[model samples]
Target: MVQKPTLAAVTHQPLARWIAYLNAVITFKTPQGMRLTNQDLTHQGHTVRATICHVGPEPADGTMLYLHGGAFMIGDLRMYRHLVARLGQAARQRAYFLHYDRAPEYPFPAALDQATTAYLALCTDPAAGPISLVGDSAGGNLVFALLHRICTRDLPRPAAVAAMSPVVDLRMRAKSLTTNRRTDHLVPTSWARRGCTAYMGSADPMNPEVSPVLGQFDGAPPCLIQADETEMLADDSRAMAAALQAQGVQVDLQMSKGLIHVWHLNVGRSPEADASVAEIGRFLRGVTSRETV
Candidate 1:
């Protein structure tokens, strides 16, 4: 079925536009929310940021080290507040947003290193137990890297990993890259390439650190990849799933229709967003519930 692109599909809400505009306007921000009050046990020296959004009733079972989407060039924790808050509600726990380094400044390993350090710190916190990782857009790329790095070092793997419209393959060779090129209103191929250039800084786009879809997920935990049918990166999930499944890894791949890019970013408004979050919530719940926890 051919889906028509709309403001909803593209996340063209006035709020989104304003946020994008603000991101473009400001290079650095204090982030409007409760600042990092303390991180002694969980994150010793790591700079782990958080925005408390209505603490749930259940015990703090686990933490979702969430990374935001901006093609790795622009965007911060605030841009994902709406979706991350709802994700916390979905998981019935707290979600910590990572204020990682951006592109054109600290490229490649810098951001990945910070995220890995933060993850290691979080794992140390018993309060932040049963940790899981998730991200959207370029953040998804980080999640892929986190999984691979953890596997390589023979460290503790997260319970599960989830990504939305992840640019897993920085080379952008996914079939959907060309298949849905004209339909994905929010992010065009040209814009994506521009951001990729800024983040990689002359590094090969296909480098596993840059494009995780081509990397290893064999020893990693359960993984899920979600993408919008109208987004050119839908094939990112397709390719990642095939690779993981080939290695006998548990993977849940969902190609949502009637949305652009990471529909889950729209959370409250887009039905597609709700569905995507719900799916991830279910995956997390299943993992934490069925297993030791």
Candidate 2:
């Protein structure tokens, strides 16, 4: 079974409301060799809270938003600070961690709307030049959704997009859900099914707005996808890559063996995680370099 809050417990316990916030606070410590500064931006009549993670004193190559993953319902800026900091160090760029609204209170398009507003604001900011987008899990879903919006609505496209262990199909039709059931412990097909029902609430699972794998990727930016070979959602990344490629979008998909879902979050502790970050950095560099040239 997937590790998550039970409905009965959440309904009875008022303290359950503060769990994500508490986790964010408890896990937050200044990552070694990194600096963090908080910033608040007003966008689309909403207060978008974010943090700028810097690795060095000098200016970075560019700016990229680091979207966190918690099935679109949980997660906070603090929980992802270190990972974003390490990403900043690897990509040679500043990482802006967006703390957007979550679901079941904010449900359906709320998170997507908040993220889109914040990203649009970032694109307009001269300081956050040549922006890119990277995310894991649900955040990866947002990244791809945003890309679809960018293509369909003529919004500014990011320099590149990288998603790790993205939940591309909310319907969970992939065969891996059954085949990798025993191998992938962190996420069970049942948990994802419940999450989709709650997070999507009335939204069609096949809608590109909800399941980005069904979205149009034509004219989208260059993309990179990484997935754990053993995870239930392993095929999510593969399916998304094929969709992007079919739409003529350049894509690179890397499958890592035996790693847990979003193992990149274990950076500084896992060698495999460290290598993944480095590979992402290299991919981003190649994309940005080609864009400039």
Candidate 3:
């Protein structure tokens, strides 16, 4: 059996600076041999910056829009560069990772709005064909929320979507909250509740858009969800897959035994992480290839 790596303790009352430093420590190495560029776009009249990563001279498939996870409060362009670059390499696709505004400074709809805007910007590019969505943790929440919005508003839909340890239910109603709390190194019930409350202020957590576990997934793109079986958010991914399936959407949910939250972010460090990225590439290829058929 492959042993799962233990995660570092979650910071007590994580602030932006604390979380940023932690992310910097975890994502220590700078990515090499990739073409990285900066692009600025306006989202709801606010400037949004995205790090565009290219693995080769030209992408053969399409572009991936990536959103990072930091409890909706931290994680940024510099923190995620290496992981996105690895994803670009493994997936054979260019990646556009957003540095969306965080909570307490910008809450709830702010991040969602920026994500939608950035996605729209990508849609305008003729070269960005069969766009796919990828995100981890809170960004995974944003990915599902954005998919709902796109379906509701009749916007251009992504060809496929993938998420890692997505926090699907803001209400924290999943049984794993109690069942796996002690074992799941990253998220404790109290800590998760606090962050969700901060992001959801005055808004109903049960609102489907706010908690995508409650949302309809009819007409949603083929979706892939990955999570650690022992993590607190395992139920979130499972329930999300069930919800998507109930709505007649194609969904693939994998709950692996030996991994921590968003372990795929480990990039070059872990063999499991590398395998997960390759699986993502396979999933994306399966979905996008069908579109051309």
Candidate 4:
């Protein structure tokens, strides 16, 4: 297998800086005819930054919240604009790409707090319509963490949820971390450990707020989880699916072969990535439709 130079770049340097450098050099073009609008979501004295993407006129169907993945240290609305726009177009709903605070600076519970606040703001808005959540990698961790907060606080639930190559386990105990080390070219275990440590700070690694695989999902909306079967985080998705199923939440676990982590970001360039995003869009549409019924 050809090694991923980008993944190898961060293995030995300051992760955040290297990722920022990578983000600067690598770019994805936003889909044409997509309307992009920036908004500040304020709730309970907290404000979260977000961008809304739509193909043409905003659809009245519903809304999708997309959280980008960069191991909690790097990633922003700019890096994921193209993918988010495509997803919104696919689901035929307005998509909001959240710009939550990152770690090594924001640390544990900061992103979670902001995400939950954003969700609450959306839920309270009658104009927001039915809401679903989609996140990748560390953002996926926040998806469940936010769900746990909603469940425990008895807040309104999202219409559906989707996680791509999510880092569900901060404790990093999954066997695939070792077994798939050779096959997974995108995420190195050491790099993942460093990212986790930066994000966790003094918090316990096993804290369910950080390691969402340990969180409660009893009342979570229907969830779609997609991950590459050979990626190091493969078991994270597997374990999360099992946990959600045990809690009686409807779950769809789609495992692909020989793909990089969060490959859905390659939509428009890779057929597999396009297919994966379409599937997620379909799942979100299906569940949100049922939610409205």
Tell me the whole-model lDDT of each prediction, alpha carbons only: 0.72, 0.81, 0.81, 0.83
TM-score on alpha carbons, each prediction: 0.84, 0.90, 0.90, 0.93
Model 4 error, position 122 (Å): 0.6
Residues 1-293, candidate 4, lDDT per residue (tens digit)? Answer: 32245554554446655665466347465577867799988888888999997675556569888877887877776678888888887787789999888778788888898888888888777888889888999989989888877887888888899999899888888999999988987777776777888889999977888888888876788999999999999999999999999999999999999998899877878999999989988888887777678
RMSD of each: 5.7, 2.7, 3.4, 2.2
How much is the lDDT of residue 95 in candidate 4?
91
Model 4 gets an lDDT of 0.83
Candidate 2 matches the true fold with a TM-score of: 0.90
lDDT of candidate 1 at residue 258, scale 0 to 100:
68
What lDDT tens digits, residue by residue, belong to model 3 across residues 125-151? 888778899999999999999998898
Which candidate, 2 or 4, has the higher TM-score? 4
What digit string (tens of lDDT, one per residue) describes model 1 on residues 204-250?
Answer: 87678788777776688888888877887777878878877887889
Which regions in candidate 2 have their CA more than 4 angstroms from the true location? 1-30, 43-46
Ranking by lDDT: 4, 3, 2, 1
Give the Å error, residue 239, model 4: 0.1
Model 3 misses residue 40 by how many Å? Answer: 1.7
